[model samples]
Target: MDNISARENRQARLKRMLAPTSAVFIGGASMIPAVDNCRARGFQGPIYVVNPRRSELAGIPCVPNIASLPEVPEVAFIAVPRENVVGVVGELSAIGVAGAICNSAGFSEMRGGEQAQRDLVAAAGEMPVIGPNCPGVANFADRSVFMMDFFGEHDQNGSVALISNGGSYLSDLGSSDRSLPVAYSVGLGNQAMITAADVLDVVLDDERIRAVNIYFESIRNSAALSAAALKAARKGIPVIAIKGGRTTAGQRATQSHTASLAGDDTVASALFKRLGFVQVSTHTEALETLKMLVHAPKVKGRRTAYATSSGTYAVLGSDIAEANGLDLQPPSAEAAAEIEKHLPPFVHAANPLDIVSSADDGKKTLDIYRAFLSGNLDVAVNVMCYPPEGGWDPTTWDTNTTMFAQAARERGLPAAFVNTMPEMISRSVRERMIAEGLVPLQGLEDGLRAVSNAIRSSELAEIVARKSDEEILLPLYSANVTNPIALDEASAKAELANVGISVPRSVVVKPDQATSFEDLTFPVVVKALSADLSHKSELGAVALSLGTSDEAWRAVCSMAENLKKTAPEIAVSDFLVEEMVKDGVGELLVGIRRVDGIGLALTIGIGGTQAELLRDTATILLPASRDTIAEALRSLKLYQMLDGWRGRRKGDVEAAVDTIQKFSQFAISNGERFVEAEINPVIVRPQGKGVVAVDAVMRLAR
Candidate 1:
C-alpha cells in the first residue's frame, strides 16, 4: 500500500482503539481489572468477555470464544498465554476488529521469542496493535481505559499525550502525583505493528491535544517520526522528548574522527533539534515543560521579570536566570520609580524586584506587578513557598498570587509561579494559580529550565514552519554497507577537489621516484600515501615544512625508513608532495557520515591534532542549508578565533560555509557508495583567500 493509504488505515484503526465504543476482553480472571476499569471510567459502550472456562467475570457474561461474540468489537484487550496471542489476534482481525492490545509477554524480550513476535505481527495484518509485552493505553478524553495495570485517576481535561517505550515508566507517570494534564498515555512495548510515530500521527489529529511527550530508548521508524514531528511543528504544537540509552558503545568502528565525535546520542540530539522537538534530560523536566507549554501563555523570547517577596529568592533568581540564558533587565526609569513607591526603602528596585511590603494589600501588589510587567518583557515569574495549609492563614499568599496572575494576564505575558522547593506549594494553591491563568511550576531550577525550553521550542517551531519541507525532512536512505574500502589521503583529497572543494596543489609520486619537487612550491609537506594508513603522523609517515627539493627528498627518505621500522608489515609505495598553507587563520574538521537510524549527519568542529581532545563540535542532519552550516560554525567554541579573536584577522567564514555545503552535497549524492567521509584541518585562510582541504579520509562500500 502507498504511504497515504497506509497512514489513513493506521489512523482509522488507532481512532477506534483510543476512543472505542465497544471493547472485548479475551482471557481468564487476569483480565478482570481491565474490564472493571473500563466500566468504572464511564465507558457507556458495550463490553464483552471471552473465556472458555469461566461463565462470567466482574458481573459480565463471558462468551466461549471469538466465534460466540455478539458482534465485532471496536477494540480488544488480549491477556492469553504468549503462544496463543497470534491465534487470538488472527481471529479478531478475521472478524474485522479495528485494533487490539496484545498484553501477552515473552515476545522478543526472551530467548526464542523472536519468531513468536514475527508471527504475531503477520497475523495482525493491517490491524493496529499496541504491544506484545506492554501495559495498554488510557484515553482520559473518552474515558476509555484498556490498561492491564492500575492507572491513577486524572482530570478528564488533559492536553498532553504521554507515550513511552518503558511500560513501568508509563505506569508510574500515569499513577504519579505530578498532575500532568494527559489526554492519552500509551506504552509502546516492542512496537511490532504500531510504532511511536503511528501513535503520534493518530493522536495529533485530536484537536484537544496541545503538546506531546515521548520517552524512548530508540526510534523505530525515523522517517515516519520526522513526518509526524513536522506535522506537529506546522500545527504549532511542541513535541518534548527524552532519549534514554545515550551511549557510544554501539558506534561503528571507522577510520575517521567523525565516528568517535558524532556518536549515536549526538546524532539523535541533532535529529531532534532539526525536527524541532524539545529535548529534556529527565522526567521532571519533561513534565514541567509540558505543564508550562499547556497552561502558560506562549513565550516569545528570554526577556523575563522575576518577582519575589524574599530578598534571598530575588538574588537567587537573578543567578538562575543568568545561568539559564534568561535576560533579567532592570525596569525602565519611570517603571522603577512607580515600583519604588510601593516597595520599602531597604528593598531596592531591580529586575528581580522585591515587593514584600506590598504583599499584604492586593491593590498595591497589583500596582507594582502591573508597572513591572509593563516593561520590555516576554515572561513574568513570581517565587512563593507556601507553608502548611492549616498551620498558617492562606489570605496573604492568596492575595499576592492572585494579583500577580491578574497583572501578568493583563499584559498578556507568559507567567510562572515558582516555588523554591518542589513540595513547598500545596495542591490547592497550584490549582488556584492555574485557575487564574498562571503556571504553578515546582522547584525553582526546573521551573526556569522549563521556561527556557518552552521559549526555545516556540522559536524552533517558527523556524520549522518557515523552512521548506525538503530542508527540514530527511529523505530515507539505506545505511547498510558491505566490506567498505578506505581511500588514501591523496585520493580522498582529489575526490573532494572534484566537488568544488579547494585542495593544496600537490603531486603523488612513488617513494623511489621522489627525486625532485619541481612541480610544487619551495616549502612543502610530504606524506607516505597508502589507503591502509589512517593516522600517518602517529606512524611517523608525515613530514612538514620542507624549504628545498633536497629537504623534501630527505624528509621522504626519513619517513620511509621510520615507517619501515615502525610498521614493517605495511608497504608505503607513494608520497604526496604539496605546498603548505601559510596564510591560514584557522583549522576545522568538516565531516559527514551516515547515522544508522538517522540520515547523513554533518559534524563541524575544531580540527587538527586536538580535534578529539578539544571535543568542541556541532552536528546537523544532512540536506542542511548554508544558513544552517553557518550557524553550526558560529556555535563552535573555536569560532571566536575564526571570527577574529582580539586583534587577529578574521578567517574566511563564508568560504568555510561553502566548503561544508559542497561536501555535504557530495555525501548526499554518493551516500549509497560511501560509508563515511571526513576532512580534518580544513585550513581556512584569511578573508578572500578561501579555504583548503589539506587532509581527508573516506570509507566506501565495496
Candidate 2:
C-alpha cells in the first residue's frame, strides 16, 4: 500500500485505540487500578469487567469470560497470565475489537517465549496490540486512560506525546512535577503488533500533537520507524528520543528488561543524526527540552541577543552563547544606538547588555529586550536572577516576563528566560514563562545549550524536509558467496582503477616469473599477495622502496623466507610489484561498514597506523549525495589539515571529494559482490594534483 493509505489505516486504528467509547477489563488482580484510572480520567463508556470467579468488581457488574460480554468493546485491556494472553487476544480480534493492550509478561522477554510472542502478534491481525508485557496506553486529551496508574489530573492536554518501552520510566515521567503537557502516553511492552514507528505515525497524523518523545530499548522495525520520524520532522514536528542501551553494560540491562537487541551505539547515533531526531541522555534534559520545544521553538539562525540584570550574568551569558554555537556579533550602529537609550550609563551597550539592578521593576529591562529584538535578531533571552527571599513577590515578575514573551511572539522571534538559580524561580513564575510561549531555561550553560539545540533542531528539520522525498538505496550483498574471501592487493587495486579512481602503476608477478622490472618505474614496492592473508604488513610480507629489479627480486625472496618462519601454515603464492607512490600531502582511510537496521556507512578518517587510535573519522550514510560527502568531509578534524593548516599549501580537497564520490559509487555498484571494502592511505596531493589509492582491500561476504 502507499504511504497515505497506510497512514489512514493507522489513524483509524488509533482513533479506536486511544479514544474508545467502551472498554473491557480481562483479568482480575492489579487491573482494578487501570479500570479506576480510566473512570477517573472521564471514561464514561460501558466498562465490562471479565472474571470467571467474580460476578462484580468495584460495585460494577462483571461477566464470566470474553464470550459472556454483552457486546464487543472497542478497546480491551488484557492482564491474563502469559499462557492465556494469546487465546484471549485472538478471541478479542475475532469479536472485531479494534485494539487491545496486553499487560501480561513472559513473551519474547523470557527464554523460549519468542514463538509465543509471534503467535500473539499473529492473533491480533490488523488490530493494534500494544504489548504482551507493558504498562498500557492512555490519551490525556480524550481522557481514555488504560495504564497501571494515572496522575494527570493537573495536566493540560498539549502537543508532546511520549511513548516508552520500559513501563516504569514512563510512569515516573508521567507523574513528574515538571508540568509537561502530555497528549498521549504509552508503555510499549514487547511491541508485538504496533511498534514505536507505528505509534509515531498515529500521533503525527493528529494536528494536536506538535512533538513526540520516544524511549525505546530496541527497534523491531527500523525502516518504518525512520520513515515515520522523517515524515514528522519534515512537518516541523520535532521527534525527541532517548535510547536505552548505548554501552555494553547498558545493552545487557536493556536485553534483560525487554528482549531487545541494542545494535551498535555508533550506528544508532548516526541513524538518529541522519533522521533529524534530537537524541538526549538524561530524563531532566528530555523534560526541559520538550518543554522548550513546546514553547518558543523555531529560530532561523544562530544570532542571539540577551539582556541580564547582573554584570556577572552578562559576561557568563556571552560565554555560554559562544560555546553553544550562538553568534553574539555586535549589532549594527543604528541598532546599537537604539539599545543604548534604555541601558544605564554605566552599562555598555553590547550584544549582552547588562541592565543594572536599578531597573529590576522590569520596564527598562523589557525595553532593552524589545530594542535588540526589533533589530531582527533570530533569538532573544531575558536573564532573571535572585528572587526576593521572604518578600519574593512573583506577580510583578510574571507580568514583566509575560509581556516580553508576547512582544517576541508577535514579532515571530524565538525567546527564552534564563533563571540563573533554578531553586529561586517559583513554580508559578516558571508556569507563567511557559504560558507566555517563552522557553524557561534553568542554568546559564544549560539554558544556552537548550537554545542552541532548539535552533539546531530547526536547521536539521529543514534538512530532513528537503530530503524527505528522496529515496536512499542501501547496499545488498550477493548470495553467491557462502563465505567471505579477502581479495589480494593486486585484484583490489585493479577494481579500484576500473572505477575512475587512480592507483599506482602495478603488476602481479609470481616468484618464479619475477625476472625483469625494467618496464616499471624506479622506487617500487613488492609484497606477497594471497587471498588467505588479509594483514600482509603484520606478517613481514611487504617491502617498499625497492629502487631496482635486483632489489625487488631480493625483497620478494626474503619475504618468502620470512613468511615460512612466521606462518608456515600459509603459502606465499605471488608478489605484487608496484611503483612507490610519493609526494602526498596527507593520507586518508575510506571504507564501507554495514550497519544493522541503517545499512552501509561510508567512513573517512585520518589514515596510517594511528588511524584506529585517533578515531578521527566522520560517516556518510549510503545513497549519499555530493553535498553530503563534502559536508561529512568538512566535519572531520583531518579536513583542517587537508585544507592547508599552519600556512601550508592547500591539498587537493576538491579532488579528494571527487575521489570519495567515485569510490562510493563503486562500492554501491559492487557492494553486493563483497561484504566489506576499504582503501587505506588514499594519497592526497597538493592542489590540482589528483589522489591515488595506494592500498585497497575487498572481501566477499560469507
Candidate 3:
C-alpha cells in the first residue's frame, strides 16, 4: 500500500479496534464475565460466541466456527487454549476482522511456547493483537470491553488511562473501591504485536485522558515510549509509572511472569526522570500522584504549612515533611497573630499551627486553614483524624472538608488532606473530598510521601517543559567488534586528554630506555603498562612516591622483576612515570558503562579507598545538560563534603561538572568502541582549581 492509503487504513483499523461495533468471543463458560462486561458497558453491537460444544451462551447465539458467522465482526476475543490460539487467530483474520484480544496463556512466557507465540503473531498480520496471554482490554469512552473477567462497575468516561504488563494490578486498579477514574486500561501480555509503547501512543491521542498510569516489568521499546511520554508531559498530561523488577528476586520473577528482560534499574530510572515521568513505587503512590496532577494546581515552591487539632500530628507531620524534602516553615509573626484569633490562649500558633485537641468544635481547624492559605506559603496540608469512640459526626466533617476545599480553590492554592488512619475516613466522605477537588490521602506516612512526590513531579515537569536546545548527543563509534579489550593506562589517559580532560603529566618508556628523571619531577609515581593487567597495584606492578631519580629507576626494575617472577603470564611492554598530585580536597570516580535498552550511563561518585564501602554513586543518562549534571552531583550523599562540609574549603565542583561533560561526549562518540571507560581517583582540588585524572582505564569492544 502507498503511504497515504496505509496511513488511512491504520487509522480506520484503530478506530474499529477501539470502538468495535461487533465482537466475537471464542470460548465456553469462561467467557461469562466478558459477556456481562459487554452488557454492562452498553455494547449494543452484535456478540457472537463461537463454541462447538454449546448452542448458546449467556443468551447469545453460539456459532460452530468462524465460517458459520453471520457477518465479519470488527474484533475477536480469543479465549481458546494456548495450543489452538494461532489457528483460531488465522481463521478470524481471514474473515477480515480488524483485531483480536488473545486472552490465552502458555505462550512465550512458558517453556516450548515461543514458536507458538511467533506463529500467532505471523497469523495476525496487519491486524492489531492485544495479547496472547493477558487480562485483556477495556475502553470506557466507546464502551469496548474485552476481558474474561470483570473488575467492577466502570464509568463510561473515566479520565485516567492505565496500561500495564501485570494482570492483577490492572484488575486491582479497575475494581478499586476508591473509584479511580480509569477510562482505558489494558494488560499487554507478551506484547507480540501491540506493545506498551504503542498503547501509550494511542491513549495519549485521546483528549479525555488527563493522566496515564503504567506498571511495567520491562520496557522493550523505550525510545518510542519516551518520545510519546515526553509529548504528553509537554502537554501537561502526567505519566505515572511503577517499574517492577528492581531487586534480584523481582527481576527473576518478572522474566518468568511476562518473558521480560529486566535491565539495569538505575539506567531505567534515569531514562524515566529525563523523560519527565512521575515514577512511583506503589499503586497508592501512582494513584495519589495522578490525582494531584489532575486536580491540584502547580506547586510554586516547597514552603508548606499544616493545620491539625492534635499536637502529636504536628510533630509527626514535621518529621515526614522534612524527610521528604518539604519545608514546613514556621508561620510569620503576623500570620501567627492572625491564627491566634481563632485558637485559645493556651494553644501555641506555630507552623503546624497546633489546635487544642480538646476543642469540641471544628472552628479552630477551619480558621487555621484560612490562616495557612492566606500566609506566605506555597501549599497547605490539613490533618483530619477522629477516633471512632469520639462519636462519628458526618455533618461536621463534611462541612469542614467542603470549606477547606472551597477556600483553596477560591484562593488559587494547592492543598491536600492527611487522614491519619485509613479506616477513620468513610468511603463516601473520601469520594466527596475528591469530587470537591481536594486530594484526600490515607495512611499518615503514605500521604505525606505522596504529597511530596506530587510537588516534586510538578516542579520537574515544569523544568522539562522549559528546556530548549541544551543538549547534543554525539554519534556512536563505528566499530564492528564483539569482545572488550582493555587499553593500557597511558593509552587511556591519552584518550581522555584528547577529549579536553586534564590528566597528570606522564612519560612512557621501555624498561631499557628509562634513563630519564631530568624531564620529570623528583617525586613521581611509576607503573608497569600492560593491557593484560587490569589491577597493577594488586600484582605489585605499581610504585608510588619515588623521591629520587635512582628511586624511580629502582622501582621500575623491581616492578619488572616482580611481574616476571610472580605473574609471568602478564605482558609488560612499557612503564609510565607520572608526576604526583597532592593538593586535592577529595577523590572521585567518573566513568561510563553501557546499560541495556538505554545507551551508555555516565556515573560519578565518591572515589579512593572508601569507594567500595561508601558505594555513593549517581548515574545520569548521557548527553545531559550542564544543569542536569550539577543537579545530579547535588543529589549525591557526598555533596556535603564537596560543598565544603565542616567549614572545610569546597572542592572545585564546577571543574568536575565540566570534566564530566567532556567525558560524557567522548563516551557517547565511542559507545560502540568501548564497553566501559573509567578514571579512578580523579583528584578534585579547591574551588577555581581544575580537577586532574590520576588513574584511568578503558575497555574496548572486540
Enumerate residue pairs that collide in model 1: none
TM-score of 1: 0.94
TM-score per prediction, in order, is 0.94, 0.86, 0.86
Point out where model 2 deviates above 4 Å.
1-11, 149-156, 247-263, 330-346, 372-374, 385-391, 399-403, 406-412, 421-424, 471-500, 505-519, 528-539, 563-575, 644-655, 670-674, 686-689
Alpha-carbon shift of residue 54 in model 2 (angstroms): 3.2
lDDT of 3: 0.76
Kindly list the per-residue Cα lDDT of model 3 for residues 92-200, writing each as its tens digit: 8888999888889998889998999899989987777888888888887778888777755676768888898878888877786654677887889888777777777
lDDT-sorted candidate list, best first: 1, 3, 2
Candidate 2, residues 1-702: lDDT per residue as tens digits? Answer: 786786677569777888898999989877888888888878878999999998787667889888988888999999888889889988998988988988899998899999999999888876778988988888888778898766455344567798999877777667766657788888898887778888888788778897788996876655677678767876779878788865542232210101121225655666677778888776656776776688775777888877776778878888878987988877778877877887667666777766554355566656666666777688888877747658766655665677678768877888888877645666676787777788787766667777777787888887776773443223333233446667777888888889889998877777677467777898999878876665567788889888888898888888888898998898876888889877788888887654444566677787765666677878766778888888888888868888889988788988888999998888677655545567877889898998888887777564
RMSD of each: 2.4, 4.9, 4.9
lDDT of 1 at 242: 91
Better-scoring candidate (TM-score), 1 or 2: 1
Question: How many angstroms is residue 67 displaced in model 1 relative to the true structure, after the best TM-score fit?
Answer: 3.4
- Model 3 segments more than 4 A misplaced: 1-16, 52-54, 89-96, 111-119, 247-263, 356-368, 386-391, 469-482, 497-500, 505-522, 528-541, 548-550, 560-577, 634-655, 685-690
Quantify all predictions' global Cα lDDT against the true fold. Answer: 0.87, 0.76, 0.76
Question: How far does residue 136 in candidate 2 sit from its true spot (Å)?
Answer: 2.0
Which pairs of residues clash in candidate 3, taking residues 3 or more apart in a chain or in different chains? 481-702, 482-702, 483-702
| Superposed model 1: Cα runs more than 4 Å off | 110-115, 249-251, 509-516, 568-574
